[model samples]
Target: MTTEPSQLKFILSSVLLITCGQFHYTFLFRAI
Candidate 1:
């Protein structure tokens, strides 16, 4: 199967969003 550029971008953006959310939660915990 061939990968589409837009589909790859969507996956990357979602992964980034999830990582950012995790990082934000960790920072908040550390600050408390």
Candidate 2:
């Protein structure tokens, strides 16, 4: 049960990282 929760957290973090990366790129493009 603990392992399942950890796995879910890892997946959620990865999705968040990707989304943040995309947003960062867009912001940079707009700044340029």
List runs of model 2 lying over 4 Å from the truth.
Answer: 1-3
lDDT of 1 by residue, 1-28 (tens): 9999999999999999999999999999
Clashes of each: 0, 0
Q: State each model's CA lDDT, in order.
A: 0.99, 0.95
Question: For model 2, how does the per-residue alpha-carbon lDDT over 1-32 read when each residue is reduced to its tens digit?
Answer: 35688899999999999999999999999999
Worst 10 residues of 2 by lDDT: 1-10
Q: Cα RMSD (Å) per model? A: 0.7, 2.6
Off by over 4 Å in 1: none
lDDT at residue 2 of model 2 (Cα atoms)? 55
